[model samples]
Target: MNIQPLFDYIRNHVTLTSEEETFLASKVSYRKYLKGQFVVQQGDVCKYESFVISGCTKTYYVDTEGQEHIVMFSVEEWWTADLGSFITQTPADYNIQCIENTELIMISSDDIEELYIKIPKLERFFRRVIERALAASQKRIIRSFSMSAKDRFLYFREKYPQIEQRIPQYMIASYLGITKEFLSKIKSQIILEQ
Candidate 1:
């Protein structure tokens, strides 16, 4: 795979020496997941931080009733992992699964730590990335609690138009904390009024 795009993405945020970029790239592994495959299951130790090169994934938790509640979705140029498990080296409380067949570049926690020792700037880069992720998650939580179903759907469409096209309706409904039927009604209402 051409790694230039990935390198450029990193370079834009962090100034990595040529040798550091080459070393970091060498440590990464390319992985592919089929639709419905679990990248990390509940109770499993999450070993890798993955960057999506293509396709989409959802991170969710199954409740006692076996209901899936989606926490977040990741599409191209996004990262997906159970950060609680990956950082703490504990078992994950959530499942991360591919919604579409996906290609990813992954680096193990161990390898990333090694990179940090060799190139300390990566630590700063990743810390900023984590901060952004936390902020985004906070915003999502506030929106889910504060917005109506129709408003949530509209917000999702405005923010992540690529996801609206690629993900199935039911999964999107779950992510929006609404029923599939309600989502259909929302869509129809918007179309008719437009």
Candidate 2:
């Protein structure tokens, strides 16, 4: 598969010389996961940072009550990993699983560190990536505290219109911290309003 998309994503944040691009290409590898496969499981060390090339994945945590709370969803052009575990080389607290058959380009933590040393611009690119991710996460936290369930659903729908069609309603509900029944009600109200 062509890796132009990955290159384009990086180039949007940082310019890469031909040699640098070639070196990056060599360090990354691709993998295909079937739906329902776990890319990273809770209690396993997260070894790779992955970029979605096709399909979707969900990063979630399981509570003591055996409920799954989705922390994030990664679709095409998005990145997914348990950053804390990847950085610290510790067991992951969350699980990353394929929601659909997925193609991903992954760089191991060692390779990423090496890339940072060899190509400083990559370090800058990743720093910005992490910053944006953290900012989005902060926004989510604030929204959860300040917004109503319907408002959260609306905001999520506006931000990720494509994702609703790709994932199950229950998963979306989980991500929004709402019950499936409540999400259904929200959808019905939206349809009636429309």
Best by TM-score: 2
Q: lDDT of candidate 2?
A: 0.96
Candidate 2 residue lDDT tens string, 64-118? 9999999999999999999999999999999999999999999999999999999
- lDDT of candidates 1 onward, in order: 0.90, 0.96
Flag regions of model 1 displaced more than 4 Å: none
- The Cα RMSD in angstroms, rounded to one decimal, for candidate 2 relative to the true structure is 0.9
Number of clashing pairs per prediction, in order: 0, 0
Q: What local lDDT score does residue 111 receive in model 1, on the 0 to 100 scale?
A: 95
lDDT of 1 by residue, 52-125 (tens): 88889999999999999998999887889999999988999999999999988888999999988988999898
Q: Compared to the true structure, candidate 2 yields what TM-score? A: 0.98
Model 2 Cα shift for residue 175 (angstroms): 0.4
Q: List candidate 2 segments past 4 Å from native.
A: none
